[model samples]
Target: MSKRTTPVVAGEKAGSKRTKAEEPGIRILGPEEFAVLVADLLPTT
Candidate 1:
């Protein structure tokens, strides 16, 4: 029988810190803004 080894997953390290450039941008949209954005994608039928 062969020995089985566990594989390490990416981004599973403890206490990992991301640099400014590596961080993702977050945006907070108002109710009106969100509705407008959704309306643009939806078809008018």
Candidate 2:
């Protein structure tokens, strides 16, 4: 069986001054990463 790895999502901490979306410190997920996140949320039969 193959091993599955979980993707990491990085972002600003709570109560940070750079809470605005226009800030340059934001982290963006690619299409593959986004799909993996969605798959993890789905119910398994």
The digit string of per-residue lDDT tens for model 1 on 1-45 reads 112322212232322332221234323344567677779999999
Global CA lDDT of candidate 1, please?
Answer: 0.40
Top candidate, metric lDDT: 2
TM-scores of all predicted structures: 0.42, 0.44
Number of the predicted model whose TM-score against the real structure is largest:
2
Clashes (backbone N, CA, C under 3 Å), per candidate, total 0, 0
Candidate 2 lDDT tens digits, 1-45: 112323334344533432332254454455677788889999999
Off by over 4 Å in 2: 1-23
Return model 1's CA RMSD, one decimal.
14.7
Clashing pairs in 1: none
**In order, what lDDT does every prediction score?**
0.40, 0.49
TM-score (C-alpha) between model 2 and the true structure: 0.44
